[model samples]
Each structure stands twice: as C-alpha cells, then as structure tokens.
Target: MVNRVEITEAAAAVVARLEAQHGPLMFHQSGGCCDGSAPMCYPAGDFRVGPQDVPLGEIAGCRFYIGAAQFDYWRHTQLIIDVVPGRGSGFSLEAPEGVRFLTRSRVFTDDEVTELAARGEPERAG
Candidate 1:
C-alpha cells in the first residue's frame, strides 16, 4: 500500500544515529504556532498520543502522528520527512544533532485520494 508518510535517506541516517543514542523513537508533526510546525522527534512514549492525534504512518522505524485538526487540513497530501542543516525545536530529540526534521508535502492525486478515502485514517498507534 502507498504510505501517507515517508523519510528520505538522509533523515533515515539521522534516525539511526538518534536511535543509537536514545533507542526506539516517535514523531509528532507540530500543531503549529509556537513550535513552528516542525516535525518533532522524540523517544517512544515521551510524547503522548491521544484522541486529538491521528497516526499517519511510520518512517525510519518510528511511528508518526499529526494532530486531528492538522490531519483534516492535510488529508489530501503525503508527508515527506527530511533533514536539513540547523537546530529544530528545543524539545525535539534531533535539535541537539544540528539538524531538524523537516516536513515536505504533496497533494494526493484523485486516484490516490480515492484509495486513501477507502482505507480511512490509519489506526492510531498504541
């Protein structure tokens, strides 16, 4: 099945380095505003996944989530997780690594949207 989220090779390498330092991880797409909407990486269970969030998919062996409201806005697109030079949010694990987890997106085509609509939102990760 086509995934709604994916990670670039560079980001995967970063994930590897992070996992070596911190173990299994997770990601939360910022809810915008103060955090500036950067995707934040955290050690698994560090960030709580509640009803307000929806699981998009996994990337670099990590679970990913988007706020329900943000998911409503982005349901038509696919998210591409990447790494860029620079520090990210202070709370994100990658911040100390001198790189940030960036989110790039593309709108889904009609057919892809139809398929996704049929599948519905993925079940939230436990």
Candidate 2:
C-alpha cells in the first residue's frame, strides 16, 4: 500500500533526536491560521487528536494526522514531512530545537491513487 505520509532523512534524524529528548512523538497538521499549515510535533498524547482528525500514517515512528477538512483538500497528494532551519509555532515541540517540521507534498499518481482507494478510506481519530 502507498503511504499517505512520509519523512525525509534529515527530518527522520531530527525526529530521532526529539524522541530521545521527549520520548514518543506525534504530529498534527491543522492548516490553521496560527500555524499556517505547518506540521506541529508534540509529545505523544500531549496534543489531543480530535475525532475529525484523519490518520495519514506513521512518519519516523510517530503517528501523523491531518484535520479532516485539511485531509479533504490534500487527499490526492502525499505529505512529505521535512525539517527546516527555523523556529515554528511555540506549541510545537520542535520550536526550541532551532528547526521546524514542514509539510511538503506531491500529487499522487493515478496508480497510487487507485492503490489507496483499494485500501479504503483512512480511519479517523477518536
């Protein structure tokens, strides 16, 4: 099955460092005004996953979610998480690390979309 979300090697290395410092980690992309679609990382269970959140997949051993509305907008694309040099939202755990988690994307190909469709709708968060 084609993964809906993935992380870059640089981002994965950052995730490893964050995991070591903060234990388990999780990510949410809300597409909200405050963060402007930036991917926010948090200690696992710290950021409550709303019922309207869709689980895209795991990235670097962390579960990644997107708001249901955002999912609808990005459903045809693959989310690529990468770490960039800068400070992000104060609420995101990566803020203090002098880097931020960013969500990059690429449109899915016809075959990949077909494969994803065969896999069925993604499960929603509780």
| Model 2, position 106: C-alpha lDDT score | 98
The best candidate in terms of lDDT: 2
Error of 1 at 107 (Å): 0.8
Would you list the C-alpha lDDT of every candidate in the order shown? Answer: 0.88, 0.92
Model 2: CA > 4 A from native? none
Which lDDT tens digits does candidate 1 get at residues 1-126? 778999999999999999999999999985787556889898999999887888988898999999887888887899999999988666998888899988999998888988888987676544
Question: Across residues 1-126, which tens digit of lDDT does each residue of candidate 2 receive?
Answer: 789999999999999999999999999999787566899888999999989999999999999999999999999999999999988765888888899988899999999999999999998997
Q: Which ten residues in a row have the lowest lDDT in candidate 2?
A: 31-40
Best by TM-score: 2
**TM-score of every model?**
0.93, 0.96
The alpha-carbon lDDT assigned to residue 88 of candidate 1 equals 61
**Candidate 2 overall lDDT versus native:** 0.92
